[model samples]
Target chain A: GAGVSQSPSNKVTEKGKDVELRCDPISGHTALYWYRQSLGQGLEFLIYFQGNSAPDKSGLPSDRFSAERTGGSVSTLTIQRTQQEDSAVYLCASSLVGSQGNYEQYFGPGTRLTVT
Target chain B: SQQGEEDPQALSIQEGENATMNCSYKTSINNLQWYRQNSGRGLVHLILIRSNEREKHSGRLRVTLDTSKKSSSLLITASRAADTASYFCATAITGRRALTFGSGTRLQVQP
Candidate 1:
């Protein structure tokens, strides 16, 4: 009955530093996604992972953005060489399945990253 | 590129009044979903309307999709103060893994 959860509700880091945001999806969820919301970018999809397949990284703005899901349950989004433009709320969501079918996604509270 | 665009960036209404928000998208979509977020927190799924279906209702919320126009509208009847939040429209494109979201509309339901 637990919903998706994220850690470090807020994070502040210096430019050029690396930051990692964590997400724990609901039980039985086979699909996970990460999105970013900023003053300038609004809300944009960053990455997606479905089952054991390769994750979709098309939305990742640059090579510095990377994510990994361990054991198909939890995911961590890492941003290297952070820039002020990367400052935003990092949100995570999970669904029973992937884009093959229409399903509702459960979202986490999100981690607000501030690159100073 | 943003696929969906919500109209009237902000809206204000009294409790018990109805509220309506519109969304327009650029490309064809398989379905459209509405989500509500309180403050800057995580989003809560409100409703989903498929391209084949013209309209759907859940509790006090009504959603209508016009695939021909690539647009949709969400109407909340008898809104309450608790309904005050930011509403967004997200479109699921064919063969796409992720949903594209609109800028969102801020609704303030005054009690």
Candidate 2:
């Protein structure tokens, strides 16, 4: 793709249900990131994936949150037992390899996840 | 603490007026960048300034950096209604490859 792409622009889910947000990064991009933004708020870091290696899941916020990246190109953010506090716009971004290369991050339109 | 923090969480000005937003970070960085996000839309990269560079300009955007203070400012000249958006500052530290973003400033331009 010419830029990063995300699915389900908006999702309304019930509490305790699990939801998966997908991210398809630009072709050849080596680093992918997930961020969450509340209404009128700044981005909250969620996860970072580089290549096929382990991801920096430090920002997942809790045990209910998890993510996976396949083939180093596509990534998914999964939130289990969704809570109202989890409602936010989940954004995906891609950039050239961080340590190995450098470029501005290309962001996706994001999926607005609402937990009711 | 988050590496970057934006000042003046919100700003409102008449169209054609200039807008200036400032950001302060806590750690040494490899580079600092700016981005703008319209309501409910994806963020658009604005400009990036390296640690060694003091200033940069592109189109109507002007950015100034002070490494000693770990601060940066973005100035938009002759701002227009189209510039009404939330602005954010992000920094990628020398050791941390992922960019850390600030809370952001919401700028409103009224005609």
Candidate 3:
């Protein structure tokens, strides 16, 4: 009964560099989501993947932000040309979608990305 | 654009006292959920209240939703010092796949 998990608890990189954050969802979870949280601010929805369907990338701020969920389990969020504004904690969550509806999401320890 | 907004950015209370936080959203929602975060890290799911549900309870937590007002409230009864954390309200808008979160309320429970 492991929960969602993320890699690189903290990452510090220079501006214009590219950074990738990874997430491993819980077993049997068909839906996965990524969100970003700035300091003293709320979480911003980034992208979502449901099963084999297309991923929802509407919330992504720019073209540089993109994510891919491979084999319906692990997801990787990559930010190209990272800017100072991209400095924030990246959170990943997963949930089960059943006949009733989408249930509560289980979140993983976020990866704090610092663009210096 | 942020859909949900929480009131009283911060609150302080003593252990055994109740804590109540409110959230108001801009558009209609399918469901509202409460989450708690510690040390500004990952969040933990607290409760979920559907649009049709007026109120729901889990342990010491009580959540209420008013679809007409597009608002929700989370009340923790007889709180403990361990409950000190940042609370947020996230809304799943109608016809939306992702949830929009509020700016959260920092609750400080003094033991």
Candidate 4:
């Protein structure tokens, strides 16, 4: 069984440019999440999508950060006008069922975004 | 901001020794999970302890949760060099899909 997978292992772009990171969750897993990890820091929640319910975007730091999960399987995180502060590892995770009691999340290798 | 805080930010020990890391949280949780990360990449799920359970064991890993104290501990026994990595504790509160994670404990197992 394939675990969660992310695209573009490493990406370096100008601070003003936009970057899109992609994630493919495991089959039959209806819950997907995005997180950001800065240098020597812990994981920060970004967004969460469970089934057809409205996605939880409260963890998004700013309006510049946005994410979308199409067909309830693949998710794309878009950062507009990236700042140097946006440089960090973007990780995606998925779980079997997103119920409140479910705690296991399989994570992807992550996409390292570097805003130069 | 993280809801959990892990003590002893970093640790170094011999391969055959045991390593213990503690975590404290500030809110009620349905479950607590432990994850391991290598080279700052994706996290590998190690163990999950439900709120009702005080202790759980998997292989050489032991996890304990004390809802009354809002704290938990992860112990790795007879660690090997391959066990060297950053370990984090995440809390899943009731009704929330996203987890709150602690900074993590960096453990180095010297062979």
Candidate 5:
């Protein structure tokens, strides 16, 4: 089966520029999530979408960061006016929401965003 | 804030030796999961242990969860050089869908 996939394996941009990263979750997956990982650091949750309900935005570091999942399939994360601090590997993952409490997540290769 | 914190930021061992990594979380969790990442790209799921599970085994991997102590441990027996990678522990909070991951342990296995 096809796993999650992300576009633009690597991106380099200047500070204050905007960038959009895309993710395609596995077919039939209802939950999608985005996370950021800085060099030698842990993953920081960004946002999550489940079914048609409201997306969880608690983890978004600032207003400049936003994400939207359309048709319950693909998701895009947009960073407006990016900052040097925003440079990191953006990872996307998807999983099936099961009756059980927790489910393992399948990840994408990720897009490394470099803000120079 | 990060919930899970893995001990020993890095580790090195010889092939065929056993390796163990530990993780500690701050809050109650529904499950704990281990993931392996190669070259800092995609992460592959290794195992998952529910809050009620105290120990689970898959192949040469053993995972133990202690809800009382808010900690978990992953033991890999008879490791191989190919096992060298970054291992991370992630916690699914009691009511949260998103997972909180630890900084990870960089494992180096010499053949």
Candidate 6:
């Protein structure tokens, strides 16, 4: 039921400020992911957490961007010294964990971040 | 920087017509997935076709994957006005847990 939920539906911040976005995954799902949708860039992967293992951070655009999943359920994405380029809709997704089995990711409504 | 790129950046068609969109990625993938997003709404997974599958169908949607060409296509037949939205193709590479999304094709189905 509860699909995926992201908090702070919309945010406006100064260019040099920092912001944190939150995500709550569906119950029983072990895989969680973060993505950014910019004006023309579509959806860009940010990071992912599977169980308690080290997250896959290959998609993070820069060192300023970091994410963490605590208790294998809630995740937070922190953007340091935000820039106009960092403004976008942050999306979260989750799915059941497995090997070549089910990989259908349920996505959240997303949080729109605006950096001025 | 992006892996997947979709064609026809935009499409406009009348209801009951067929709409087709194509996507091409840079690297080999284990599976390809299609998603639809209405204006201001979250994305909804339409279908997924593994690399091993050449074509797959679900209701009015048809997805075809051509690994050789590193491309995929989605066809929506007898589309309704409600079908107007942005369609995206995502490719999941082998060994990676994230899926790379394309630029997306905006389809406008007029009633």
Model 3, total clashes: 0
What's the distance in Å from true for residue A58, model 2? Answer: 1.1
Show where candidate 4 strays beyond 4 Å: none
Off by more than 4 A, model 6: A98-102
The CAPRI class of candidate 5 is: medium
lDDT, candidate 5, A1-116, per-residue tens: 59999998999999999999999999998999999999998899999898998998999999999999999999999999999999999999999983233888999999999999
TM-score, structure 3 vs. true: 0.96
lDDT of 4 by residue, B1-111 (tens): 689999889999999999999999998999999999999999999999999999999999999999999999999999999999999999998878898899999999999
Residue-wise C-alpha lDDT for candidate 3, range A84-105, written one tens digit per residue: 9999999999999721234888
Alpha-carbon error at B20 in model 4, in Å?
Answer: 0.4
- Candidate with maximal lDDT: 4
lDDT of 6 by residue, A1-116 (tens): 58899989999999999999999999999999898898755798888888978888988999999998888889999999999999889999988993342487889999999999
DockQ score of the complex predicted as candidate 1: 0.61
lDDT of 3: 0.92
- Model 2 over residues A1-116: C-alpha lDDT tens digits? 49889998999999999999999999998999899888877788888888877888888899999999988888889999999999999999999886722468889999999898
- Candidate 1: give the clashing pairs: none
Identify the superior model by lDDT, candidate 1 or candidate 6.
1
Question: What is the Cα-based lDDT of residue A69 in candidate 1?
Answer: 100
Give every prediction's interface RMSD: 1.9, 2.0, 2.5, 1.0, 2.0, 2.3
Listed in order, the DockQ scores are 0.61, 0.60, 0.61, 0.83, 0.67, 0.57
Once fitted onto the true fold, the runs of candidate 5 whose alpha carbons sit more than 4 angstroms away are: A98-101
Clashes of each: 0, 0, 0, 0, 0, 0
Among all candidates shown, the one with the greatest TM-score: 4
lDDT of model 3 at residue B62? 95
